[model samples]
Target: MTAGVQATVNDASGDPLGAHVALVIVVVMVFWAFLVAGLMFEPYRQFGHTGRLLQLTGICHLLTVLQDSRSWSLARVGDVASILMLGLLAHLILTLPQGRIISGRRRAAVAGMYAGVVAATAVSLRYGPGFDAGCDCFPPGPELSAAAQRGLLYGSAAFFWAYGLILGGVLIWRLLIRPHPAQRRSFSLAALTGALTIVGVGGRLGLFVMPGTPAPDGPYAVVYAATLTTMVLGPLGLVTVVVRARMHQASILDATVGDQGLLPPSELENALATVLKDPTVRLTGHPPVEPGRSGVPLRIAGDHVVHLTYSSALDGQPELIRSAAALARLTLRDDHLRAELADNLEAVRASRARIVQAGDAERRRIERDLHDGAQQRLVSLAARLGLALLQLSRGQHATATATVTAAVGELQDALEELRELTRGLHSPVLENAGLAQALASLAERSPIPASVMATGERLAPAVERAAYFVAAEAVTNAIKHSQAQRITITAEIRNARLVLTIQDDGIGGARATGSGLSGLADRVAALDGRLTVTSPPGRGTALVAELPSPPHDLR
Candidate 1:
């Protein structure tokens, strides 16, 4: 009997160390598991608030686990902190993917949830039973009447149960209301994990409040297993999301860079949308400034080429977005260049058509002028000469001399009219002399009091022609329509480009789209120049034309 008792005492003494070691190992394993989750989440912190919140949730879970350690004296602190952490978890659920409390109502709801948790914790710590009847792990609560304690416990349990139900319902609603199939797919696993966690915790709390519940040994094992499973699945779910995001990023890169030919803007947008699972994705040449929209600029060689805009729901996947942008930089840049080239070619075609049409109209005008003025005068001169010949043959000397003199006068007038018409077709002064001489001659002919200022630089024929026409058209318009007393024409070479300005002090309601000005604009644009007309009502009109003038040798 004595030997048996001694053996029993030795056995009992050895078991405590083994149990303590086992507990330490369990704690170490939990700590390592949470640590791994934290490390996994660390890389995503730069992406957005979602990653940071996930890390925070993992830390809170670790702390909650520590609170159950008998060796750690953290029960009193854990009681309040753990409940608050759970409230944070609830908040995290509602703001999944983005992890932003987007609305005042949602912020208020989260605040109220924390407030309820605090109130419940106060009641549970004060009047409610502190010691679990099943596990007997906690110390006894303060002395209270049975009725008060029971009522408080039931109230706290009811509040927690409502919290769980509301969170679950919210998860379901989020799943139901998600408009995008991609969003639903991305949110499903996390939401399911969160729902399971709520169920496990609510089940344990429900069992805790029951009367005459047995120890947490037999029937309660399943609930414990479920709670533990939920804890493990929570971190796993987060890891899965991150992994999936990385995979999506890889796919985005492939879709953007794999194509041999440049994708059109529409096709590029479609490709990104399909890969990212966002139907709201689009490409724009300008920044997105709309509410609830986010933009990622695709740049090449430090120049912004285009912007990628999408719904704010995808804010959580910043790395994925950035990777796609990086890969698409060259492609988007090429596409932008191609689009610009297409626009320029179209403009060139339209300008050429307009020029051809203008040439045709000018030819028709020349034909009409010849038939009406020079040709009619020549025919009249022919008849007058025939009359003079008839007089000479009849030996009427004075009559014949008068007829001949009249014919000479008519012939001189017809030649002068033809000279004027030829000058109208192409100015001799402009073709022979430089732009300065051209402008001077133009100013001298203007109906209004006009002045000319030019640098007297010889330019390419095309440049000289454009400049001359711009000045002539401006002077004519000022005379005909502006009713101005004075007109100014200034041309100078700045940065190897001709900057011409035509200013008039007149009624300044001139529009760039007016027939004369529009034609002049097209002429200027044909030389890769810009024409700006600033004619505010009641202000003087200023028509400025900037045209490229390459070096003399280059031209």
Candidate 2:
């Protein structure tokens, strides 16, 4: 050991080996603290960094192997081993939690610098004029360039070994410091996992630094076993705790949503309770439900078409959406109601289909009647009037002239009336143009300011026609019943369903009586689609209708 280090150690420098060992232990302990923390907190990059550290640790182990089998020809090999140990120590300390964690371009630049320094030093150990004996930290050895080998050996031994013991001890004590809440059956899993992850790292590092030296000579084997156990079990313990916590949460959620097939009694109560995280959901109604049976019921004002809704915590939103759907489906389940709706739907189809065919046939008949009957007679009458006017022009009497002029005026009036009648028979423009142009004409003829917007992919012709009719009826109602000043129609396709909305600023008490809205509701129902009206008191009105992508039966 060097007399200078011995003298620096508090006057009584009798045992130089012990003092050197103390210094080695302190340095490695500080470095290990940061590395373990990085492993836990930064986890991903830190674990990646840990993998490199592990490789470095393995490198240190391999170096110890070479240092054991020292040779005369490979005399410079010990300096190479010492340099590798320096790199490994840097590996552990550099990625420690306290160390700056960096990534991407910045990390790459730093890594390149770190590599250059190591490469330069490694090249020097083989070629440059440098210390060539042993690990610079411990055991005074043969002088290469006049430095004691024991001075390096005893110092590294004192520093790294003592530091490893203290680090392991502190972490083990920390594990014993706090007991978990003990509230869950899974608390033991947490306690064991969290403690071991910390203690394992401490122990594993101790084994690496303390062994293969004169000081830890006999105690090395025992410490290594304990440290190794802590290292192996740490991850397993942590995973066990996490898995248990997840399982507990899943069980609680299953109990809340519904235990399989049971339907709830009161939707609103469960919704309110679930929001509050009240242990059990409370359904509305008397006869108090039991065994987690709260649910929403869907039924009509009268009839056995009743069903209750219980749902998984998925798909539908606002909790009550499932209830609303259930009610709609329930309304359709009554034998009589279903039959009536089916008949109503069939009637609508039959009526509109027949009306279209009848209107076309009637249009042809009216055109033929105008040409063959009224138009022919008017043409003959015009010929007769022309002949009489010609007579008057060729010097007829005054009384005859007056009579011909009056007769010509009466023919003109009759022709005007016939033209108005033909226009009313059925609009030719409505048949020639598609629904949008027809609606534009209809809107131009309206009292209110109405507008329509269509976006997204367009719908099938029949669906567009139904939507057009609905908009027209809504505009008409806005003017007649609701006293609305302005109305807007919006149509779009979202996720294969066609959505049509009619919104109006009007006095808001509109009901689905036998008028066109009721017809629209029946029409949508016939398509196996849905119709909803939100006309809140004093809040104006909105009518929403959704139809399937393929509304009409393909057959």
Candidate 3:
């Protein structure tokens, strides 16, 4: 009532939804932006490429354009923001070639062209024209119009962006309509971000080109009353979104996950296979991957031996070991209590492998059952029904009457059962509709209460599969081990990777190595993924797994 009254009795008139709500959205958005800088660090970071960061970036950028945007014009900040945005976009485009998938100069060249525009514009502002004014893109006086080519070039870039947006919007439409795309990984981050930037550009200027403008005496008059607001805030939105991507990646690396690039791939692989894979390896870091693959194969040298305290609490008094011994002891257990924990660890490991194999076998068995059993029955039944109908039409009514009626009804039931079986066994919706929908189905069917959230605009099949399996495993574990009430599963795709997180509020003291969670980590690692289990004795268990989102999505 208060809001309605204030709006009704307001002195100004304009777009209430557009101006007022847009302004509030902007304020809320700007405030929400603190999270992104923590997520976008490096590829291997813990906080890297997350969903919240991505969403915040997009929202905050749009919010800056709502009202009083022009007053934001400050010294070199705008230029720096523009440069960072252009660099980020250019990096995205250029990295496609570096990723070795594109293997062509075309995309890289496009990146260079965009970067060149930034450089040229910067140079023109400094030397070619209006050198006295600071790095502000918008000037208040008549002298600002003197920098003609800079404006034209900048405007042209915006126009190109608008074109890209139009083209991308079409692609988004296509993906949505025929979402069960035959191909996956066809979509890229570069494409999504570019499309968003284009949308931002066109949206900011869309009103002017419309058939008619809202009366200037309306609510938005307060919003557009100052030219600086739009000029500064409009483009800032795009910049914020892109920069936020970087921040997200950075934050993850430092806080959540370490920069594994510090170790060579082979070495890190060995370390994980050796220490981390050990079923008996308590909450410690140490191991030998395989029987002969131990002692750091001559080929694998480096080690990032971050301390891992193994069962120090329940078991009491933790022991520390060097990189090599830690790796060995962590896996095989070389201490006095090792014998006691051995059976438990082995059981955990065995259960982990068994669950994985059983899941696969179940799927195969169900598939075979359908193919060999129900399908054949349906085919035969269909033929029998058809033959009966033919006989009845040919004036053999008495002969065909019972058989035709029975066969027809049987066929309908068989088909329905097959459909139900299929839905339960494996979802075609998951395969065709993609991971997000598949997870939604899983959440609905979860015996234990569960909530699932998917983050990517689009996902590759491998990623979708990884996410599906991870959630399945997590939920299964929650039911069998944790005795938890609710499980929350989140799948976020960012920078060619998918991070799967499953958490439950249940009994504490759940050990990853001794419980189903340890095996879950091993499974993820086998697929070149990483898993982290955070279960403080009394706190709820939080499980996180990171899997490589294929550079090329194969649907």
Candidate 4:
């Protein structure tokens, strides 16, 4: 076990560069397979050519890499293989998307490209200098001068890339003139692939054209680097095209599933037509007929039709005429009841949320009434008690003076307690002014130094009440239990929700289930809001609450 653990650690700490390159190569191979699979399974036969050519291209590139493992003399065989692949690529580009060649002239041009590659490879094997010794004895071979061999190599390189440039021009033209959006997307991918391959070709041509110029690396190195880069990116380009096509298909399916029951019958027909990609799609519901005599018929324009029969149990029900799209019947059949139930469930949830909000509003109203009415009256009573005590203290009734003073003190205490209770219930500032002012009042009243940072448009009354209560409870708990030096309350409105957070710098370990915090949570819940308290040992407590706030226009 110890040795295994040490080995695992060593593997985990292995050189990252080799691991990364391996991962990239594996991903590229997977993407190559995905692209080929997407093409091979395409619905149309016209795309078969491009898919087959790409398959050949992938094979040729793989062989090129494998050639590096062979002896250099044997590796020369890959030259013609590489040239044939490029010729095939040119053909693929010229006839992208629907891969059938458009005209005889275009077909002839593709044939000429392949012919040129074959002739050049033949010339190189015959008249050109050989890489291995066995070729010295071959008969009927032209013995070319070194300079002539160099010129032949340069000429071949130039011709190959010039053909590539022409193919690139054809791809660009197709992209510009293609009328269908789907075909244009495929053309775009073909164009990008062509461009990258052309760049690599141009790099090779550069070496041939400048024999006297010193290369940054050896010829083989530059060619291999360019080839590897194209191999990696070409698969990615094809995969992008495949992904986009699948996404478009998925969107159609998604629309069918989502809007089946929502649209009117005529509108639903149009929607189905869009999803099925057949504009002629229509629906015609029929009255119940003899159970087996004549069933429902589903037809796609210019395609074979299918008849669906109703069971004896469903004989009395109206016949649903589903769209020709596969699975459309399943979506449309008996969906009304499900849609109605869904709407009812949503309405119930909304109603419950409103009731919770109304409770919070009622609480705020009571708090406001208590503060402005009864609390004010009590304040006046406290003033009267103080006046009576002052008068008795002046010696009008010496023995009763002490009793009045004590009673006056008690009244003063009651007034203070009432003020605390009203603040806790709901801040008068929150009702009249806004949440910011209420939070500021809270910060001022907190035993520890506290600050309020709030911004954004004023929220609804219920939202304000919920936020105020949570902040008050959190502040009270933090000051009472947490030996905090300071507290901070932050409030903001975002995406029509009021987010309020309170934090303290003190000994932590506050629990959400504590009576004060739990009651705060209940108040928040009554407003369809959420409250969370987070405190860890040695980390100060924090409380966050989120409340739904309708738009100002809505309010």
Residues 1-555, candidate 2, lDDT per residue (tens digit)? Answer: 132223234223455456445434432433353344324433333124543454444344344324333474344464455455544444433333223345465455346435643554443332232223233333454444323333333344343443334433432332233322212233344335434433433343333333233233234323433443433343343334335534534543443344442223333345334432333433322322444333444444464334333332211122233433343344334434657789988877875775566557657878887787677767767776787777777777675676577667767766775764554443444456644565566567678887867653445656656666666667767778777888887777666677888888888877755445666676676666788888887778899988776533211
Candidate 4 residue-wise lDDT, 251-370, digit = tens: 545665553344433355666556444354445454235533334564423343434443332121121122223444544443545666798688567656666775677688677866
lDDT at residue 421 of model 2 (Cα atoms) = 56
Q: Which pairs clash in model 4?
A: none
Give the residue spans of candidate 1 off by over 4 A. Answer: 1-48, 65-75, 103-105, 123-142, 176-179, 208-214, 245-258, 265-340, 346-449, 453-487, 491-499, 502-527, 531-544, 548-555
Off by over 4 Å in 3: 1-426, 476-483, 494-496, 508-523, 533-540, 550-555
lDDT of candidates 1 onward, in order? 0.71, 0.49, 0.50, 0.60
Count clashing residue pairs per candidate: 0, 36, 38, 0
Candidate achieving the largest lDDT: 1
Which has the higher lDDT value, candidate number 1 or candidate number 2?
Answer: 1
All candidates in order of lDDT, best leading = 1, 4, 3, 2
Per-residue alpha-carbon lDDT of model 1 for 23-52, expressed as tens digits?
334334434544565567567743245555
Candidates in order, TM-scores: namely 0.56, 0.38, 0.28, 0.40
Q: Residue 442 in model 2: shift from native, Å? A: 3.6
Shift in Å, residue 3, candidate 3: 99
User: Would you give me the overall lDDT of model 1?
Assistant: 0.71
lDDT of 4 at 413: 67
